[model samples]
Target: MRRLTKFSSAVVGLTVLAAAGTAVAAADQGDDWPYAHHSAASYTLAAVGDIACEPDDAENAATPASLKCGSPTLGGMSAEFATAKQATAMHPDAVALLGDEQYQVGKLTDFEKSFEQAWGGLKMLERPAPGNHEYYPYAKKGDNEAGQNGAGYFGYFNGHDQAGTPETQGQAGDDTADKQGWYSYNLGNWHVISLNAECKSDAFEHDCSTTDSGLLGQETRWLSHDLAANRRQCTIAYWHQATFSATTASTATVPASAPGAGGAEGAATDAWWKLLYQHHATLILNGHEHAYARLRPMNPAGQYDPAHGIPEFIVGSGGEALDTLAGSPGNYDNPNVVTAQAGAFGVMKLTLRSHSYSWDYKPALPGPGFDSTALKYSDSGSGTCN
Candidate 1:
């Protein structure tokens, strides 16, 4: 196990003094901001997963039944559109897209048509992770998307320069300059990381925890090193699957298209959670379960502790479709879960401070205000970094 340093605390004290300089540097790195003029004292971020609409007819007529398709309501426009609208309304400095940005086999065509239509506006500000759908194999030969290797994902975010064909660019995750989705950046005094979690072949029990599979395993090694070298007081890690799941959704650890729906069985992410917890990571965000669930502070071992623990949030209600919230909040099988709710599509907004963070999550309903029917899944609170 590892521990955070005192020097990180010292740095947080002076974050405001250097916010102006850091913000300018971050923007120059090619990340987008709504406008040039904004406060440097604190930054707001919007994070959600299982986004965009699924691709139904985007495929050919002869596509095999093995490749699933569905008729989304209004082409999944209304649900995803609402979330994107809410995200932009908050005017976040950056939007952390946990994963599953595209659905029903993450084809580039689907991304352009369904995802791009709704959340494409946030592409300039999105820091994304690859989900199982992104790695799903092509339904047929010679299709536009490269079969299941996340070429489309990398191509969209990292750019298509000479680094490597834009599609295959960051799929390697070797910690090189071009490692694509698994990269880190600074937000004021906080250091945030986006990790890739798809491991093993697409038809077996996921080897998500095997840190020796070479390609995806290399990413975890890089994460360990990245944490050891960090000097920031606050840190947040985001990925597609939740390590500690909390609802009735499927959390199978198998290598299927929708493994670990609620994330209860997602031991693949546990390896990374160990590292994050050891370093006293402030927060962990994930998608996959199509509901919003917040867990009580707990250690990597799933034991609760207020003094030294990391809180996890499952904000998968980013659109697509809604999964059931299972039984209830405290009644769930997972002991750490405090709240879980569904039937609403929305985004979680975070106002990241120097050493603390305040989060406000609200999902939009059809007509007026937010969703408050079955459960008041919406939440607002503050927490300090460990």
Candidate 2:
């Protein structure tokens, strides 16, 4: 497991330096500032996923017109760039990327040409989770071709060295023999876990069974240990596909048996949900549905459990074309969904405190057929950890 590096430590160091400077300036004025010695009690985190269209997708004439590159533009910039701009403007202490950050095979070239050009500025501040796209090598969904084994995704994050093999560069543990990409870290007072959800990929020989021998099983075991060791008051986990979907459009296009058949991935994650529920996890964030939806807190059984349930936020509206919500406006197929919107690209800003957290969803650009009203669409709320 890769550990949190000097980047996060540098952020803390800078905060201390800033505080020292403020104290010196205050002392020169001969005024005792009560808040001088106290550092900020909360930190801001910006999150989003399902970002960046392939630069060559348009020329290749990909299906579902929305998949074409250079589309859903705003003010002469692509939607991905717009949302990146929005997140950058917030200057959050850290960025939690849910998944599907690079689309259509997630090759290194594609990431460099598309994702890097847009979201690269946040690289140092980002804690990323892998998506199906990062594992699969095919452009179309449900392809049986050999996958990238997370070579591109891990190479990009772990720092690609031309001389080293992908496994040596930490390619989601495909060839690492032991460690997978799942890891945990602390952000302020909150514990953050980034899990690998592409267990069904060919990289692991398609072993996602519930037993301890399967790849996902190993991940679950690690999660159990991680949670047991964690002492933070608030904890959050993020990955690619959600166990509870907020959009029906994803399942509408493919057969239920397909590799990434929307709900199928969700079903496969039941074990994860169960583990998190037992651990009293505060939140789950995911992407893959290409829309944004905030679900009410619920237990692993999908029943509303306000007292001990964990709420989930599906913030897939990073840049790719938005998916249709589960139902008509103001109504939803999933009763647990509190609010959802599909005609905008945006990011979720999370203010994490000691034992509580607040969220603000800001739409940075309009999707196809959406007017200026899309920019006005907003959702904000606060919740306490269990």
Measured by TM-score, the strongest candidate is: 2
Candidate 2 residue spans exceeding 4 A from truth: 1-39, 57-66, 71-77, 139-146, 167-175, 251-261
lDDT tens per residue, model 2, 1-386: 11111111002121322211211211221222221222367777889998888665533454444444754442223788899999987667667888887776677767777899889887756678888888866645433324666777877776666753453433132336455577776765688888887777876667766456877777788888889988877889888888777787665654322323455566667788888888889889989878888877777877777778788888999987788787754567677777788888999998888878888887898887888887777888777776
Clashing pairs in 2: none
| Clash-forming residue pairs, model 1 | 250-261, 251-260
Error of 2 at 276 (Å): 0.9
Candidate 1 residue-wise lDDT, 117-172, digit = tens: 87877665676777766775544533433355565566555545554355333322
C-alpha lDDT of candidate 1 relative to the true structure: 0.66
Q: What residue runs in model 1 are displaced by over 4 Å at the alpha carbon?
A: 1-33, 56-75, 138-147, 161-180, 201-209, 251-265, 366-377
How does each model score on TM-score?
0.79, 0.82
